[model samples]
Target: MERLFGLDMQLIADTLLTAISVFVLFTLASYLFFDTVRDVLKKRQDRIKSDLDTASKEKSDALCYKAEYESKLRDADKEVEEILSAARKKALQNESKIIDEAKEEAARIIARANGEIELEKKRARDEMKKEMIQIATLMAGKVVAASIDEKAQNLLIEETLNEMGDETWLS
Candidate 1:
């Protein structure tokens, strides 16, 4: 037993042997399992990176789709406005056409009424002229047959009007 620095030689030898054993064990574990752990970590990192890329692509696609949808919505709105405007214009045209037709119909009706009025007036005048001619013929025959002074002529005219009656003159 050598005792230098108040430590036993046997204890020092045992401690050194334990340290070497631990070092050897650690070295063997590193050699066997380090590559597998590194490979697993690398695969995990690759998977995470791939997932991130896929997520980013999906996000970009979603943004594009959103933009396209918005554009389409705006186009649809514009189309609707155009359709509405066209409809309004058509409606106004129809209104104007209807008004014009109504005006023309009114004018035709007024013209027809005026023509009928003129025809009625002409007919009434012709009837009056016929009645007047018959009355004049009767008076002439009476005058030629009788030698009439003013008083007799007046009496004859009065008699003739009485015979004709009020109803004849009114008609």
Candidate 2:
């Protein structure tokens, strides 16, 4: 029953008892809920780790698909180039063939025209020769009818035949 500050021994004992009771209550609450809170935290960490793993796998899949599409695009470009090259080669060959045919046809036409020209020239020479022969015969008849003596006429005809040359009427 020693009082240091005018406080009663009963009041001090009641305060001490209340403090001890509150400490006990706190210890019991910690004991009961500590495992439940730890379990909830562990579950949340596992769920976050699983979501991160899924995101990583999806990223890897997307990268693989992108690489595959790029490879296909390159192949398609090569195929298109090959097709264009073949078409160009074929077109060049066709152009050369057409040019060669045109040259051959032109040569044939020129040769035919030359042959026709030669034939026409020969025909003109033959007609001129025939006209010359008819005129010479008419002139000779007129000269003979105008002559009064037969001997003079026969001599003149022989001299004219000699001057005309041997090959003039032979062909």
Candidate 3:
């Protein structure tokens, strides 16, 4: 086994110290590795704690934003309701005003029409009265033209009265 790599016993004896030095270096490297791993573990634990705190703060912020949004929505809803109520009231007022104005205008038109009808009736009565008066005057002149005597006028008046019925003439 010693002569397998063609090394002499003298070389082996010379390399014994080198082998011990190499083993010592290996042991020291192993110790350093463990210490570095311990430090990395501690840093990783701290980083995880910080990340957890940040996540918690973000969650709290999200809850706060949600509450604020809900509050704003409620306020907006109230404002909208108030505005709708006011608009409805205004609309009702306008409708009443329009109805009242229309009623007044219709009443005025009806009154004017009634007045025109009364005026037309009165004018027609006056025209009929004028025509009846002219016919009565002409008939009286023709009857009195033959005899201007009082006895002839009395006889004519008696004959005209005899021809009239009580239903056709008031008197």
- Candidate that scores best on lDDT: 1
Q: Which candidate is the best by TM-score?
A: 1
Report lDDT (CA) for all predictions: 0.85, 0.80, 0.81
Q: Model 2, 18-88: lDDT tens per residue?
A: 98998888788768887788789999999999999999999999999999999999999999999999999
Steric clashes per prediction: 0, 0, 0
lDDT, candidate 1, at 159: 79
For lDDT, candidate 1 versus 2, the one ahead is: 1
Q: Estimate each model's TM-score.
A: 0.61, 0.56, 0.61
Rate residue 123 of model 3 by lDDT.
Answer: 79
Model 3: worst 10 consecutive residues (lDDT sum): 162-171
For candidate 3, what is the TM-score?
Answer: 0.61
Off by over 4 Å in 3: 1-27, 30-43, 137-171
Error of 3 at 124 (Å): 1.9
